[model samples]
Target: MDRAEVTELVLSAKRMKGLTWKDIHEKVSVSTSPIVVTAALLGQMRLEPNEAAKAAELFGLPEEAQILLTEIPYRGSLTEIPPTDPLIYRFYELVMVYGTTWKELIQEEFGDGIMSAIDFDMTMERQPDQKGDRVKLQMSGKFLSYKRY
Candidate 1:
């Protein structure tokens, strides 16, 4: 499927009920935009093998949709959002909320720069909480220096 078709499919999933991009963000293991994750639901975006597998089970994407997702896509923002449509915006929210901590920690670990989401690794877990199930995201990316090193 193309971008439009995929976007629709992602937004239409029963599993997606009551889920916001924020919920998905906390379940990741790396610094990626929620757009990337939510867009993946459309079967238009590529996912890591394990991630793809998980999505397949969760969303029941058709075989073609699965294949199409693995191919690099012509990316776009569904709305007037910056590098964001609906899917990616969820990830941006995390950065906006916990960005200070992330910025500080990355600076402490590497320096003043951001990590490469393209060359990153992430893992997620679900923990039972008093209020609800909490998602634990653990991510490690090869940090890139904002300036010439």
Candidate 2:
């Protein structure tokens, strides 16, 4: 089965079993964050063979679905260029407005290197406020400098 089919099966099983991503992640014992585990379930990341088997056992997935989980997926499933969803669009707008500022600050502080998403960690939390609760997004990525040819 393709990644999409596997994703559907996973979602169906999750709904039927009333399982959360955190539940599956913990049960599967995958050495990754819940968000990463969710990404794998959504067919955005590849899982190791053992991890796939664990996930299959936890989600009642078939052997073919486990195989699909271990295969590399075509990441970035967004069909639109600038996301149409309001929440996601807000991020796009933030980048449009502060992209230059972020670039300048990062370059000044970290040299001509860029942050590596491959070696990144992110967390989303709620911050208490007088007016209303605010979102706190913490992201850390390794800084990689350009290699001189």
Candidate 3:
């Protein structure tokens, strides 16, 4: 099966079993980061063989699907240019509004460098607020400087 098919099968299995991402992540317990592991199941990232086996067991996936999980995926391929989903579109909007500001700030602080998504970690949590709850996200990525030849 293709990676997309495997992903669909995984989603179906997750629904049938009433499994949350957290539930699967906890059951597999392979990666420290839930986000990374979730990305792997969503067909955006690759898992190690052992990790794939664990995920397969948890999701009742076949061996072929488990093997596909261990293969590198075409990252950022699923989303449209503008991202049609409302929640996803908000992220695109954030870039459109603040991207230049972020670029300027990063350049000023780090000097001709960019953050590495390949070596990144992110956490999301809910913040208790009096009026309403807030979503808090923390992202940390390694900075790579441009090399001058």
Candidate 4:
């Protein structure tokens, strides 16, 4: 099966078993963060051999599914340019509004460089508040300086 088919199987199995991303991650012992595990499930990352086997077992997936999981996936599943989903759209909007500001600040602080998503860590948490809960997204990526040619 292709990565897309495997992804659908993973989703179906997750729903059938009522398994959370954290649950699957813990069961598979694949990643420290559920986000990474989720990324694998969504076909954004390749799973190691052991991870693929464990995930296949946990989800009762076919043997081919395990093989498929080990293959590198075509990342970025969004079909449209600006995401149609409201939650994702907000993030797109955030970048549109603050991307330049972020670029400027980072450039000023670190010189000519860009943050590395390849070496990044991200976490999401809910903060308690009297009026309403607040979502906190924390991300840290290594800074890569441009090499002079």
lDDT value, residue 140 of candidate 4: 100
Predict model 1's lDDT versus the native. 0.64
For residues 48-98, could you state the per-residue lDDT of candidate 1 as single tens digits? 655554444445666665556566776544555454566577787877899
lDDT of 2 by residue, 1-149 (tens): 78999999999999999988778888775577877788889999888888899989987888999999989899989889799999989999999999899889999999998988889898878899999999999889999998889
Each prediction's total of clashing residue pairs, residues at least 3 apart in sequence or on different chains, is: 8, 0, 0, 0
Error of 4 at 84 (Å): 0.3
Q: What is each predicted model's overall lDDT from 0 to 1?
A: 0.64, 0.88, 0.89, 0.90
Model 4, range 49-102, lDDT digits (tens) per residue?
Answer: 898899999889999999988888888889987999999999999999999999
What's the TM-score of each model vs. the native?
A: 0.51, 0.88, 0.95, 0.94
Whole-structure CA lDDT of model 4: 0.90
- What's the CA RMSD for each of the models? 7.4, 1.8, 1.1, 1.2
Off by over 4 Å in 3: none
Q: Using lDDT as the measure, which candidate wins?
A: 4
Residue pairs that clash (backbone atoms under 3 angstroms), model 4: none
Which number leads on TM-score?
3
Off by over 4 Å in 2: none
Candidate 3, overall lDDT? 0.89
